[model samples]
Target: MTRVLALLLLLLALPLAACGNDDGEKETLTVFAAASLTTTFEQLEKQYEDDHPDVDVRLSFAGSSDLVAQITEGAEADVFASADDKNMAKLVEADLAAGDPAEFATNTLVIAVPPGNPAGVKTLADLARDDLQLVLCAPEVPCGNAARTVADGAGLTLEPVSEEQSVTDVLAKVESGEADAGLVYVTDVKGAGDKVEGIELPEAASAVNHYPLVVVEGSDHADLAQEWVDLVLGAEGQQVFADAGFGPPAS
Candidate 1:
């Protein structure tokens, strides 16, 4: 009787030990992404997690330049996605990126205004009005560069009240009525829906920014990082981006 009880206890403990091992050994893949990709990437994160139960997909979103700075400063991440080629090249040139960054999407700049258009901001030139408060992304940021291209192309010199570090920060100012107008990506205006209204800028065509994605060097989960990259380049990812108002990537 004693031997039988001992054997039963050992058998029960085996599966419990296995459960502990499985639970303790799960993998995590961290992806640093452009701020504009927040919503769509969140959707992709959920989908990837559902498909790969053993791996946790974590995301950190910020301005592309800022994200690159973080990585170059020794931040550990499995993947990097930039809102423009300039920032991606910084990583590639520094040997911090693992592979050729693939162009995933393109975006055009637009003028975002709070609900009701209180400032009556109708065109890019209107942003130059002395009384109208304007916010823009800092020149180092991708969106800011695009905004500058459009402004220069249209021969409109804009005097902004503030220059934010990220495009989302500019959008936030417009949405909260802190600024009368802001220059942001069309996708951001769409993402904000009724909170803000977008005024199309024709010169925006001349300053479209191409977004890129790549795996990071020295990542412990390079294979998983590549898988995430593939997923973003695949049909489902394209559809999600398209639905979010992102344009097709330029060749």
Candidate 2:
């Protein structure tokens, strides 16, 4: 009877021990970011995880406008990063931002075409050719907004074969040969390597998009979210952006 009672007590303690293990479970931090930031943010995610063993970083990438819509519609996110200030402004106006947004980087539009330049897209003006299949981001997206700005500044009108929701979608259309040319950010073109060739647009200077980041209001992990914001605005984070072909934040 004594041995049986001792065994029963051990079993009871085992369950308690198992319950205690849950205390070490990592906290999850969800981040919503613009599609243009995919590469850089992925790199940052890995670094952040390495440095913070107790936190799991989750990233959702999409067009800035789409991301704003998601956050405004009550999607739970700890952090938000926008490809342009206009979208970030919407978040602020909606009172979804926990803090003032910080400008982190800048990007400009470029024309991406398949290898060998099959359509001979040499300049922004060339995008106007009716015979060419041009893809661009929807005007509501940051990339699309910048494209329109540059085109209008040049006194030219663009007629795209498709208007995608994200910059990545525009690049994909060009990469898959679905479109002869697409207006994508310079970072996207650089990240594409030999899959596509980029044609520099002189007018792109007039439409540089400023990237911003902010902590979302009512985040369960508000402290962790602020830490992430600090990391991004810190020296190491800026280095990662620079290595990814992103321009420094405007003064």
Candidate 3:
């Protein structure tokens, strides 16, 4: 009967759709990382893919806070690499990170400006000016915390025009000329190339940010997750990160 045939076709279509979805899954390893890791991670992703043809590395880069929140909500990430120890420790506290995390690298904060320094900003104190539109990472994030420490050490109060969720966002504002000056990691300046210029500030010498990476606990793919972490911490991974301008890890 035609009616029976139609019902059978519909049921067949349902399994086909489900099959497609399952095929799409394809052994993915989800990595939650800080926005600043974009460039280096992309390179590592490619290298990793070439090495493991069957496994796909899926990355979601954002403010470490946001990523941590997602993981806490059970987003099912296999790995986490934060810009600072705070976020990594938060994962450890939540029993989200596997094993002991290690400090991978260090980065110094700098005052990033448009390529030409059109605002004529020259010093960290210049960020205090009411006329120069400045962007800074929110204090909840690692860069922001470093910014604050630098500001306090210099006895300066910076009222940024915008408190960005991530260092990359702050750099973006400067790159787009939306902001006259912004505080960002030295690695960001290196990554931005000519899009932005770095003006090293003495206050920046005050606080150093250390990055840490870890595999999450309860990962179904713990071995794969740790391989990714090992790549980031091992000589090859460390070389990639260091070449990108991150400092030697805390010994």
Top TM-score: which candidate number?
Answer: 1
Backbone Cα, N, C clashes tallied per candidate = 0, 0, 0
Superposed model 3: Cα runs more than 4 Å off: 1-25
Q: Write model 3 residue lDDT over 1-251, tens digit each, in one string.
A: 99999999999899889989777766889999999899999999998878877689999999988889889889999999898888888888998878888788888998899988999999888999989899999999999999999999988998988899999899989999999999999999999899999998776767998888888888888998988988888888889988999899886
User: Which segments of candidate 1 are over 4 A away from where they belong?
Assistant: 1-19
Candidate 1, residue 152: lDDT: 89
Span of ten consecutive residues with least summed lDDT in model 1? 147-156
Q: Is candidate 1 or candidate 2 better by TM-score?
A: 1
**Residue 161 Cα positional deviation in candidate 1, in Å, after optimal superposition:** 1.4
- How well is each residue in 104-140 modelled by candidate 1, as lDDT tens digits? 8999999999999999989888998999999999999
Give each model's whole-structure lDDT.
0.94, 0.94, 0.89
Relative to the true structure, candidate 1 reaches a TM of: 0.95
Q: What value of lDDT does candidate 2 attain over all alpha carbons?
A: 0.94
Residue-by-residue lDDT tens digits, candidate 2, 1-251: 99999999999999888777655678999999999899989999998999988899999999999999999999999999999999999999999999799999999988999998999889889999989999999999999999999999999999998999999999999999999999999899999999999999989999999999999999999999999999999999999999989999995
TM-score of 3: 0.89
Number of residue pairs clashing in candidate 1, backbone atoms closer than 3 angstroms, sequence gap of 3 or more or interchain:
0
